[model samples]
Target: SQKIEQNSEALNIQEGKTATLTCNYTNYSPAYLQWYRQDPGRGPVFLLLIRENEKEKRKERLKVTFDTTLKQSLFHITASQPADSATYLCALDPPSGAGSYQLTFGKGTKLSVIP
Candidate 1:
């Protein structure tokens, strides 16, 4: 069976520091990877997407890296602040030979930035 994983515990950080999140997947080949930020009681918002062949991507303070060989992705946020806090999620579609696919999300990592 395919599996996706993220930190179950919350991360607490002071203002102006970097917050890192990890996503690991196994037993499948995904064509693309996506990262999203979700606040409590709301849906996730797309942040970045990286193809299987891409190594890294960045937009403003957010960056995402994909490694097909390792079947893992790393998400980073620099210059963190209180407003930057949220549960971040990574998603991917595992190939189903039937030509049908759906996006699967990992349990998000909660980030807390102290003032």
Candidate 2:
């Protein structure tokens, strides 16, 4: 069974600083690593995805890194603001299935940016 873990503690950062979150998995190797943001009472919104072959990926003020060997993924938000505050989740598809769209998500790390 594949298990994913994120920081159970909430993350707090000052506005304008960079916020980095970690996700770790065991027992399986996924082909893609995905990051999502979820606000209270809302569904997770897709943020970024990095393929197993890729070392890193970036979009706007967001960046994601996947290290297959380490079985970890790091998600970064540059120039963070209060509006960026949300629970971030890491998800991955089943390791050995073709046409499988199922994804297992981490417990998520809540982020709060203070001004």
Candidate 3:
């Protein structure tokens, strides 16, 4: 069966460096991918999405790369800070009819930005 996975462990980083998180999957192909950030006791907030045909996508201080050939995605936060500490999740969209798409998320990677 298709599965999405992330590091089950937490990541520790310094306050001024780039933080890299990884997402990996297997057994099936996805139509697109998405990343979200979730804080304790709060729902996830959407961050970035990329289609299978796209190689890479970016926002102000975040970047995402999707390699369908490898069935993996890499999420990056440049110039990360203590305020940026949170759990990041990666999701894969399985093919579905329009307006009926659903997303399944990986376990999520917890990132801690130390002072």
In order, candidate lDDTs are 0.89, 0.92, 0.89
Q: Any runs in candidate 2 off by more than 4 Å, and if so which? A: none
Q: What is the clash count of model 2?
A: 0
| Residues 14-78, model 3: lDDT tens digits | 98899999999997778889999999999999999998899999998999999988889999999
Question: If scored against the real structure, what TM-score would every candidate get?
Answer: 0.93, 0.95, 0.92
lDDT of 1 by residue, 1-115 (tens): 6689986558888999988899999988788999999998998999999998889999999999998888889998999989998999999886857476778889889999999
Candidate 1's TM-score reads 0.93
Tens digits of per-residue lDDT for model 2, 19-115: 9999999988898989999999999999898999999999999999999999999999999999999999999888775567789999999999999
What is the full ranking by TM-score, best candidate first? Answer: 2, 1, 3
Q: What's the residue-level lDDT of 62 in candidate 2?
A: 96
Query: Which of 2 and 3 is the better model by TM-score?
Result: 2
Which candidate achieves the best lDDT against the true structure? 2
